[model samples]
Target: MRRAAIVGTGAIAAAHAESLRALGDRVELVAVADVDGERAAAFAKEWGVPRAHPGLAELLRAERLDLVHVCTPPRHHVPIALDCLAADVHVLVEKPPALSLSEVDLLVEAERASAGRVATVFQHRFGPAAIRLRRMAAEGVLGRSLVAKCDTLWYRGDAYFEVPWRGTWDSEGGGPTMGHGIHQFDLLLSILGPWSEIRALAARQARAVQTEDVSMALVTFADGTVASVVNSLLSPRETSELRFDFERATVEVEHLYGYTDAHWAITPAPGHDDVAASWREKPSGVVSGHRWQLAAVLDALDSGEPPPVTLADTRITMEFIAALYASAFTGTVVKAGDIGPDDPFYKSMEGAGAPWADAR
Candidate 1:
């Protein structure tokens, strides 16, 4: 069994710890680390972890871990991942893997030289229904994807941003686009493929924060499919939704956080009534979460291959976020590969600051 550890004792860390326990047959939860010593100790005790350290350095020196989950906040993802890379330990980092496209590129460069691989936690892509959707798309059962809509409308009040790191560009990245909506849209991108261009707008609608509480964009895929996107932190009756219109069927899913196959529905187009039966044939009851993804990660490692949500695919999602910010701030249509080394958005999602920075 591979030895593993977690580097943060936050709310999200519990999910990672539980996921590790669920995959106990293949890995051992050896240790845990957090800046808060007492909290780390408490977490270790609660989770039955053997060791607890005050920081990553201590945990690294104390245990010969094979895999490390970087469950810390966004700002610390890169540095900790870099440390893991230096130690040749594979990493399964949380979402918003790094704060910027440049930071992701840095990981890309470090990953090239390290013995271990870096995979982002995008568990939604591993759900049984999602796998079925990808297979159906590949088999042309859904036909050519024509248009889509992705919306992550969730509510967060001022108290939510009181955590100090919740809203800032440097700390949490670019608001809901980088945080809340990324999971839904990343799954969308996984199913639809590479996005070619985007034009977007952002605003600080309700939440009193440095970043936009609401963002909307029109994205065009390389395959000529078009999608309307929205990420918001100011909705009352909130939901996470995606709708894809293909030549043969319209596939849609609606859920709040995690989803099972039941949340998905497919409406067959004329002369394609068989699509409904095909959808029903897929497996069900698997909810999207860390457990599903952790299993895949271990399987990949066992096979001597890189894990799911590889850094290359991660770059696509990160670049898309950067492009959205670049377009929102500069009011320009940003094409794929436009945020190169020289671009401001490549260095940071703020990209010269949002238009309403001073006003907020």
Candidate 2:
């Protein structure tokens, strides 16, 4: 069995523990660590873990762990993941894996230096519906992909930002674009492939935070497909939705947080009844969450291969976020290659402060 540990004791960490438990004999929850000693011990006891430590360094020294889930906030992801990789422990980090492209590059370097690999948690891609959609698209069942819409409009009150790191670029990255909508967009990228450019606008419409409460972008994929993407924490009626319009049909998934096969639907275009039937015939069973992704990660480790949501795969999503910020700040279209070494956005999502800084 693969011995695993969780690095945070927050709600998300508990979810990770639950999923690890659901994996049965494939993985063992050996330890849990939190900065708060009491919280760590309590979490360990609550989750039936064998050990608890106040910090990862102590846990690393004590346990022979095969994997460590970095469930800490966005700022700590890179450092924690790097530490785990250096100790030859595979790492599965939460969303918005690193604050910037450069930080992600550092983790990539560490992964190259170590025997173990690093994977970002993009569980949305693991759902059976997502898998089937990708397969159908590859097999030409979707025909020529055209326009698409991706929305992650969820509500977050000002109280949510009372946590010191919640809204700052130094910690949470960049509001809804990085924290909320990323899951849906990552799934979109997984299906549609690399994005070429983005034109975007960001605003602090409803919340008083360092980052924008909402952002919208027009993304152009390398294959000539265009998508309208929106990330918002101001919406009253929350929903996570992705719709792809193809030559043969319109395929969509509507849900909040994780999704199963039932959340997905396909509407065939005129004379495309066969495509709709085929979509229904595709495999079903898996639901996207920590459990499914963890299974894949453990299997990859067992087979001595890089896991799903690999650094390369993660870079695509990170680049898109960078481009979105860059476009919003500069009021110009940003391309995939635009935010490289010399780009200000490469190091910070604020890009020399947001364009609306003066207004705010």
In terms of TM-score, which candidate is strongest?
1
Per-residue CA lDDT of candidate 1, range 1-360, in tens?
A: 999999989999999999999889899999999999999999999999998999999989999989999999899999999999999999999999999999999999999999989999999999899999999998888889999999999999888899988899989998999999999999999999999999999998878889999999999999999999999999999999999999999999999989999999899999998988898994589889999999999999999999988999999999999999999999999999999989989999999888888886
Spell out the clash pairs found in candidate 2.
none
Q: Residue 316's C-alpha lDDT in candidate 2?
A: 88
The numbered model that scores best in lDDT is: 1
* Least accurate 10 contiguous residues by lDDT in model 2: 281-290
Q: Deviation in angstroms for 63 in model 1?
A: 0.5
Q: Estimate each model's TM-score.
A: 0.99, 0.98
**Clash count (model 1, backbone only):** 0
